[model samples]
Structure formats: structure tokens, C-alpha cells
Target: RPIFWVGNERTTDHIHSILTESEPWFEFDTSRLEYINRIKFWRYLLGNESFDADYWLTRVENDFE
Candidate 1:
């Protein structure tokens, strides 16, 4: 499946209502850093604080139109 988020990085203020109601989401314990063909990636689990979730809704709309 494809995954994405919408808006600026600070996105929790938008989706907390829906996400907080359903489950006890947990943040990753460590950064997901890896190397692929000498290219390195660094991903940290800021949990809800990570990406702008509002971006998700926007993406859906974009796809629909």
C-alpha cells in the first residue's frame, strides 16, 4: 500500500481528535536510519509530532480531483 501525509511538518493539531480516540499509538524507539547503495536515510519516530497529518486529507482530495 502507498502511504503519505499532508500539510506542514507540524500536523498533529489537525488529526489528534480522530487518531487519539481509536488506539494507543506508540512512537518508534529509535531512528530508522539505513543505507541503500551508499545512500543513507534517517527517520525518527516523533509519533503524532512527526509529519503533518493534515497532509493526508489533502492528498486524498488531490487524488479525488
Candidate 2:
């Protein structure tokens, strides 16, 4: 399984646009996509703090907050 790392929501949108506009044959596996917080990962890797798993999950935006 290949992992697609999307830095932020904007990047995700950009990738989607490219895929929709150019590559009609490329099919992405949503299950292998990893959305992570780079800063959090850096801090954790440096032993600054523990890893935050919650931050890595996609934060869905609903019509009603």
C-alpha cells in the first residue's frame, strides 16, 4: 500500500484538481492517504512531545459547527 501525504487541506484540493484535470487513468486509494501535521511530527521526532494521533485524522468541516 502506498501512502499519500497531504500537508494541509489546500494541498489535498490541489492534488484533486490535478487528478481530475489531467490523469483520468490514475485511481487513488483513499485508505492509504495520510493527513498529518508536520509541526507535530517534527516535535515528536525531536523528543519535544508525544505524538498526537488525533491531529493526523481528517478534520471534516460540517455546515453546522
Candidate 3:
């Protein structure tokens, strides 16, 4: 499974610490995990357009799948 760490810097750093501590117990490859800032993730999803609830929902669903 792929793990997406999406949050601000502080939260992401906290997540990173947790992941590092638990890496030895993880069954899957840790390399597959990714750390993406929330702002960048939103930018990637929204592109140059304004916010659309349906579009955001659909994009998140499709991308996760």
C-alpha cells in the first residue's frame, strides 16, 4: 500500500517521525510511501481553476483508486 502524508510542515514532520519509528514493523516497502505538502497537493488537484466541491471529490476518489 502507498501512504500519502499530506499536511503542513509540522504535521508532516511528526508523521515522518512516526513512520521512521515504525518502519521496522511495516510489512510492505517503505520506499513506496510519499510525503506531499498540503498546499502542493491542493495545487496539483485544483490546477489553475477555482475550487469545485464535486471536482475535488471526484479527483480524490479517482486518484486514490
Candidate 4:
């Protein structure tokens, strides 16, 4: 499995140092943090058994507008 590091420059630098010390398919970048967060949010919502469809629908509509 590959480990992706997505964060600001400082954090990426820190993670790069750690990964260099214990390398394991590391890929570091300082971007797409927002996209990654949205992916995680949707994954959590879809995976939850007690998902609130109405709430998320309203939230998504509001987010788009």
C-alpha cells in the first residue's frame, strides 16, 4: 500500500523526513487537502449505517448554492 502525504509545505517537509528515515512507498505533496477532506467526509457518510439522507441532501444543496 502507498502512503500519500497531503498538507502544507512545513508538514510535508516534516513527513518527508520521517518517511525518509522509514521509507515505505511514500508520495508527498502540498496540495489537495480540501479534496482529500471531502473524500473522507463522503466516505464516512456513505459507510455509516445510521446515515441521515435528508440532512446530507440539504447540506449538499446548501453547499452548492
lDDT against the true structure, per candidate, is: 0.30, 0.39, 0.39, 0.40
lDDT of 2: 0.39
Evaluate residue 61 in candidate 1 and report its C-alpha lDDT on the 0 to 100 scale.
36
> For model 1, how does the per-residue alpha-carbon lDDT over 23-51 read when each residue is reduced to its tens digit?
23433322111111011111134432224
Q: Is candidate 1 or candidate 3 better by lDDT?
A: 3
Count of clashing pairs, candidate 4: 0
- The digit string of per-residue lDDT tens for model 2 on 25-60 reads 434543223223443455567786643334333343
TM-score of 4: 0.26
- Could you tell me how far off, in angstroms, the CA of residue 37 lies in candidate 3 after the best superposition? 0.5
Which residue pairs of candidate 2 clash? none
Clashes of 2: 0
Q: Pick the TM-score winner.
A: 4
TM-score, per-candidate, Cα-based: 0.19, 0.20, 0.19, 0.26
Which residue pairs in candidate 4 collide?
Answer: none
